[model samples]
Target: MFKSVLVANRGEIACRVFRTARRMGIRTIAVYSEADARALHVREADEAVLIGPAAARESYLDGAKVLAAAKATGAEAIHPGYGFLSENAEFAEAVTAAGLVWIGPPPAAIRAMGLKDAAKTLMIAAGVPVTPGYLGEDQSEATLTAEAARIGYPVLIKAVAGGGGKGMKRVDKPEDFAAGLASAQREGQSSFGDPRVLIERYITRPRHIEVQVFGDKHGTVVHLYERDCSLQRRHQKVIEEAPAPGMDAATRTAVTDAAIKAARAVNYEGAGTIEFIADASDGLKADRIWFMEMNTRLQVEHPVTEEVTGVDLVEWQFRVAAGEPMPLKQDEITLTGWAMEARLYAEDPANGFLPSIGKLEHFVMPDGIRVDTGVDQGGEVSQFYDPMIAKLIVHAETRQEAAEALAEAASHVQVWPVKTNAAFVMQCLEHPRFVAGDVDTGFIAAEGSDLAAEPLSEMGIEDAAHRLRHFAARSGDSADSPWHSLTGAVGFRANAPTRITQAVVVDGEAHVARMLDDDDHPMTRLIGLSVTRVIAFENGSAFDVSAFARGGSGAGNPASDGSLRAPMPGKIVATPAKAGDTVTKGQPIVVLEAMKMEHALVAPFDGVVGEVGVSVGDQVVDGAVLATVAVPDAR
Candidate 1:
C-alpha cells in the first residue's frame, strides 16, 4: 500500500476518500483553492497544500498546480476523486510519468471511454449493446438536423463529451430541435471545450441503471450488481438505490454480464460504472437495455453500492493502484440489503432549483444515518463549485423500509439562511409513484411543481405566531412586557388552553393568527433569529417569519417593479434585452452563470427597457441590479 496519497479534488468526495485512506493507515493529503481555506475537508487531512485561486479553472482544474502539490508534499499516489481532473487522460499520464501511482484507470482506458460517440463505437465493436445514435464527424447544423429526422422526433441531443446533464437536451419535435441543438452545443463548448453532439432515439419512459465494475492491475474484473438512478431533475440524479427495486434475476444477469464485457474491452482498472438506459415502457428486459455511457471514475452515488455490498470502493482503488489482485471475485460479492442515497444540495426548489449561496447559519444533518458532507455551520456555499452540501445514505432490510427511513431522515434536515432541497427530497421519497417503483427520468420534471408546493399551512402560521409571542416576551423584561400587557398577564389556569389573537409576519406578509395559548401546536420546532424574528421548521423546510409590530403593516417589497437583479453572485453570460427594447413579463433579459448553471433574470412586468446596467461577461454580486424596465405611460 502507498504510504501517502493526495486527493486532487475538493468538497465531499475529497473528504470521503480521505476517510478511507486514513482508515487504511495511509497518510491523507488535501489540495484546496483559496475559497476552501477553512473547508471541512482541508481540516481533516494529515497534510494540506494551497493549489490556486477560488475559480476552478485557476485552481482545481490546474493539473500543474496539483502535481506540484503532490510533489512538494511527497504524496506517493494521487487520487482524483470523481471530478475536476479525474477523467482527464493527460493528467493521469502525467501522474504515472512523474513516477507516482495514479489511483484510477490507465490513461488509455480513460481515452477509450472519454467521448460518448467513440465509446459507443468501441462498445459496438466489442459486441456490447449500444444505443443507436449518429456519431458522424460532420459539424454542420444541417447534418445534425437530418440525422434527427432520420432518427425520428423525440430524440436526445447529447454532447459527445458531456456528463452530469451538462450539454444534453431532449427535443420533442422538429420545431424545438434547432433550439435544443444550439443550447446543447453551447453548453458542450462551455463545459467540455467540445462543440460536437450525437443524436439518439429518446426512450419514452427511460430508467437509468448502472452496474459498478472494479478491475485490478492483474486483469481481474468483477461486478457489484446495478443501481437505479431514475429519480432525476433536469437530467441530474436526485436519488439513487442499489439492487434496482423491480429487477429480477434474469435481467440482473444480463446487465451485469454486459458491464463486465465493456470493462474487459477497455482493459479498465479501478472503480468504473457502466451506465445503461432501459426502455421501461415495458418492464426491464434484456433486449431493451442499451449502453448509454460509462463514467471513468468514481461516482457521486457510489455510497449506495457500498452500503449494499459491504465493500470499501476507495480501499479497492488503493489496492488496485498497488497492482494487487481483485479483493473479491464476482461470485463472492453479495447484495445484503437495499440501500438508497439522496443528494442534498444548497438549492431552492421553489425558485427553479437555482443554487443558493450564503453562510450556513444553522446547518445540521439528521442523526442515525450516514452523511457525507464537506461544509459545516458557518461555512459558505461558494459559487465556484457544485452546490451539493451532503449526501444522505440509508440501508434497510427491504426497499420500502429503506424509502421510508430515508424520507423520515430527510424531513429532519435543519438548514437555515442558505436554502436547501431537503424538503424537495423528502417529497420525492414519499411520493406515491416513487413508493410504488413506477418512476422514470422525467419523474421530477412532470411532478416538480407539486413537489415544491408552498409548505406553510394554517397550522404552521398559528404555531409560528404563538412561538413568536413567547420569544418576544422572553426577550423583553418580565416585570414590564408589552406582549404581557396585551394579554393582561392574568391567566387563572396555568395548563388551560386560552385563545388569543397574535400578529405575526410570515415571509414578510403580515397576518393576525388566532392561537390557543398552549404548547400543543402541530409545528413546534422554532429558532429565534432575533427578538422580532423566528424561523419555524416544518416538513423539512424553514419558514422565516417575524412578529408583526403594533400599527405597522409588514409589507414586503413590491414584486411588480421591473428591476432585473442577479439572484446570486455570478458572471453575466447573456444580455438579450438592451435599453429601449420593448419586453414582456417573464422575458429573459439577463442570464447569470453561477455554480455551473445559467439563470435567466426575467422582466417582472411588461414594459420598455429603461436601462442596462451590466454587459455580458461582467461579474455581479447577489441582488445587483442588471437592468430595469419602465411601464409605458398611458396618456
Candidate 2:
C-alpha cells in the first residue's frame, strides 16, 4: 500500500477519507483554501497544506494547486474525495503525470464515461440497456428541437457533462424545449466547461438506484449492491439507502449486470458508482432500468454502501492504486444489514428550501449515530460552497427497522445556532408513503409540506423556560423562576402590547407568529416553538422552562439575544479571532459569502465578543452562530 496519500477535497468527505487512511496506517495529507485553514478536515489530517483563497476556483477546484500540494507533501497517491476535481479527467491525468498514484479510475475510463452523450453511446455499444434518446453531436438549437420531437413529449435535455442535476432540464412540451435546451447548455458549459447535451426520454415516477462497482487493475471488478437515492430535493439527493427496500432478485441482478457492463466497457478501476433511473410507474422490473450516469469517484452516500457491505471503499482505493488485485470476488461479496443515510443541510424547508448560512453556536454530534461533520459550533456556514452540514447514517436488520432507526437517529442529532433539516428528515421517514417504501424523485416536492412540518407541540413553554433559565443562570439569577406563570402574563403594560414576530411551520405552511395575549393560552405549540420560542425534545411529553428575567437582577427578564442573520447557505470563506478579541456591536468579526455572494455578519449590539467560534472557510447552515457577544455591564 502507498505510504502516504492526499485528499483533494474538503469537509466531511475529506475527514471521512482521513479516517480510513489512518485506520490503514497510511499517512494522509489535506489541502485547504484560506477559508478552510481552521476546518475540521485540516485539523484531522496527518499533514496539511494551503492551496489558495476561499473561492473554489482559486483553491479546491484548482487542479494544479492540488497536484502541487500532493507533490510537496510527498503523497504517493492523491484521492479526490468526490466533488471538485474527483471526476475531472484532466485532474486524474495530472495526478498521474505528477508521478503520484491516482486513487480513482484511469483517465481512459474517466474520459469514456465523462461526457453524457459519449457515455451513452459507449453504453449502447457495450450492449447495456439504455433509455432511447438523441445522442447526436449537433449543437444547433433547431437540431435539438427536432430531436426532442422525435423522442416525443416530456424529454429530458441534459448536459452531456452534467452530474449533481446541474445543466439538466425536463421539457414536457415542444414549446418549452428550446428554452430548456438553451438553459441546460449554458449551465453545462459554465459548470463543466462542456456545452454539449443529449435528449433522453423522461420516465414518469422514476426511482434512482445506483450500483457501487469496484475494479482493480488486475481486470477484476465486483458490484457492492445498490442504493436507493429516490428521495431528493431540487434534483439533489437528500436521503439514500443501501440494498434497495423493494429490490427483488431478478431486477437486482439485471441492474447489477448492466452496471458492471458499463464499468467494464470503460475498463474502470477503483471506486465508481453507476446510477440507473428505474421506472417505478409499473413497479421495478429487470428490463425497466436504464443507465443514467457514472459517478467516477466515492459518493456522498458511500457510507450506506459501507454499512451494508462491510467494505471500506477508501481502503480498496488505496489497495487498487498500489497495484493490488481484487481481494474478493462477486460471489464472496454479500450484503448484510440494511443502511440509510440522510444528508442534513442548512436549508429552509419552509422558505422554498433556500440555502441558509450562519455560524454554529451549539455544535453537538449525536451519540450512537455515525455523523461526518466538518464544522463545529461557532463555525461559519458560508455561501462559498455546498450547504450540507452533515450526513447521518444508521443501520438495522431490515428496511423497516432501518427506517425507524434512521428517523430516531435523525431526531437525536442536533446542530443549533443554525437551521437544519434533521427534524424534517425524521418527518419524511414517518411520512405515510415513505414508510411504505413508495418513493420517487418527486417525493420531497410532492409531499414536501407534510414532510417538512416542524411542529413544536406543547413544549414551547418548556423551550422558553430553558432559554429563560439559561439566561437567568448566565445573569446569576435563581434557576427556578415562575417562567410558566410569567409566560404571556403581560397583557398591555402601558403603551403597546408586546410584539413577537416569527415564522412558524404549520401543516407545511409558513404562518405569521402573532404575539399571544395573556389569557389566550391554547397550550398547543406551533413551528419549533415548544410553548413560544421554547424547545421540546423527543424524550419529553411536557416541558415547562422558567422564563428568564430581564436586566438579569432576578426581578426582570434579560434582553433577547440579538438575532444572527444568515446571509445565505454557503461556506464560510474567512474569519479572524483568538477568543480574547474585544469586539463592539456592528464590528466586522467575520466575512461570510454564499451563492457566490458575500456578506459580513457583524456584532448585533455593542458588546465584547465572548467567543469567536469559527475560523475562515467553514461550511455552515442557516441561523448558525458566527460569534457570541457579551453585553456590557451598566455603569
Candidate 3:
C-alpha cells in the first residue's frame, strides 16, 4: 500500500477518500481552491495545498497544478475522487508519467469509454447489447435530422462527451428536432467543449440500472451486483438502491455477466460502472436491457453497492492500483441486505429546484444512518461548485424497511437559511408509487407538484400561532420584568388588561392566533428558536415559521413589491427587458447562472418595466434586484 496519497478533488468525495486513507494508515493530502480554503476537507487532511482561484478551470480542473501539489507533498499516489478530473484520460496518463500511482482505471480504459458513441461501438463488438442509435462520424445537421427520422419519432439527441445530463435532449417530433439538436450542441460545447452528438432511440419508460465492476492489475474482474438509479429529476439521479427491487435471478445473472464482459473488453482496472437502460414498459428482463454508457471511475452512489456487498470499494481501488489481485472472486461476492441512498442538495424544490447558495445556519443530519458530507454548521455552500450537501445512505433487512428508514432520516434533517430538498426527498421516499418500487426517470416530473406542496394544515397553522404567542410573550418581558411570571397568559395584566394577538407566517402564508393561558401546550415542541424564525418538526416534516409581534415587520415577500430579484447568488447572463418596456406576466426578464444551472427571473404581473438594476455579465448576490416592474393603474 502507498504510504501517502493525495486526493485531487473537493467536497464530500474528497472527505470520503480521506477517511478510508486514514483508516488504512495512509497519509492523505488535500488540494483546494480559494473558495474551499476554509472547507472541511481541507481541515481534515494531513497536509493541504492551495491550488488556484475558485473557478474550476483555474483550479480543480487544472492537471498541472494538481500534479505539482501531489509532487510537492511527496504523495506516492493520487486519487481522483469522482468529478473534476476523475474521468480525464489525459490527466490519468500525466499522473502515471509523473511517477505517481493513479488510483483509478488505466488511461487506455478511460479513453475507450470517454466518448459515448465510441463506447457504444466497443460494447457492441464485445457482445454487450447496445441501443439502436447513430454513432457515425458525420457532424452535419442534415445528417443528424435524417438519422432521427430513421430511428422514428421521440429520438434522443445526446452529446457524445456529456455526463450529468448536461448536453442531452429528447425530441418528440420532427418539428422539434432542429431546435433540440441546436440546444444540445450548445450545451455540449459550453460544458464539455465538444459540439459532436449522437442520436439514439428514446426509451419512453426507461429504468436506469447500473452494475458496479472492479478489476485488478492481475487481470481479475468481478461484479458487485447492481444499483437501480431510476429515481431521477432533470435526467439526474436523486435516489439509488442496490439489488434492484424487481430484479430476478435470471436477469441479474445476465446483466452482471454483461457488465463484467464490458469491463474485460477494455482491460479495465480499479473501479468502474457499466450503466444500462432497461425498457421497463414490459418490466425488467435480460433481453430488454441495453448498454447506455460506462463511467470510468468511482460512482457517487457506490455506497449503496458497498452496503449490500460488504465491500470496501475505495480500499480495493488502493489495492488494485498497487498491483494487487482481486480481493474477492465473483463466486465469493454476495449481496446481503438492501440499501438506499438519497442525495441531499442545497436547492429549492418550490422554485424549480434552483440551486441555493448561503451559509448553513443549522446543519444537522439525523443519526442511525450513514451521511457523507463536506459541510458542517456555519459552513458556506458556495456558488462555485456542485450544490450537493450530502449523500444519506440507509440499510435494512428488506427494501421496504430501508425505504422507511431513509425517509425518516431525511425528515430529521434541520437546515436553515439556505433551502434544501430534504422535504422533497422525504416525500418521494414515502410516496405510494415510490414505496411500491414503481419508479422511472420521469417519476419526479410526474409527481413533483404533489410532493413539493407545502400546504399549512389547520393544525400546522395553529402550532405556528402557538409558537408565535410564546415568542411574543417572551420578548415582551425582560429578565427583571415584574410581569415575567405571567408567561403564556393571554390577558393576564400586571399593568392593564388587554387582549393580544400575534401573526405568524408559515411558508409565506400568514395566520393569526390569540394568546392563550395554557403554559404547557403538549402539541407544540420547539426544536429550534431564533428571533426571526422558529423551527418545529411535526408529522415527519420540518416547519419553519416566522413570527413577529402584531403590526411588526416580517419576512419580506419580494413578489408583493413587483420587483424581480435573483433567487440565488449568480451571474446575470442575459437581461431581456429594458426600462419602460411593457411586459406581461410570466415573461422571462433576466437569466442567471449559478452552481452550473441556469434560472430565469420572470415578471410577476403585466406591467411596465421600471428599473433595470443589472446588466449582462454582472455578478449578483441572492435577493439582489435585477429589474422592477411598475404596477399598471386601473381605468
Best by TM-score: 1
Residue 401 of candidate 2: its Cα lDDT? 91
Sliding window of 10 residues with minimal summed lDDT for model 3: 488-497
Question: How large is the C-alpha RMSD of every model relative to the true structure?
Answer: 5.5, 12.7, 6.5
TM-score of 1: 0.89
By lDDT, the better pick of 1 and 2 is 1
Writing each residue's lDDT as its tens digit, candidate 1 over 245-322 gives 789899999999999999999999999999999999888998989999999999999999999999999999999999
Candidate 3's C-alpha runs over 4 A off are 457-533, 537-544, 548-564, 571-591, 600-621, 624-635
Alpha-carbon shift of residue 155 in model 3 (angstroms): 2.5
Model 1 sits at a Cα RMSD from the real structure of: 5.5
Model 3 lDDT, residue 80, Cα: 97
Better of 1 and 3 by lDDT: 1
Q: State how far residue 355 of model 2 sits from its true place (Å).
A: 1.0
Off by over 4 Å in 1: 457-459, 467-532, 549-557, 576-587, 603-614, 628-635
Query: Relative to the unseen true structure, what is the C-alpha lDDT of residue 161 in candidate 1, on a scale of 0 to 100?
Result: 91
Pairing residues by index, what is the TM-score of model 2?
0.77
Model 3 clash count equals: 0
TM-score of 3: 0.86
Output the better candidate (2/3) by lDDT: 3
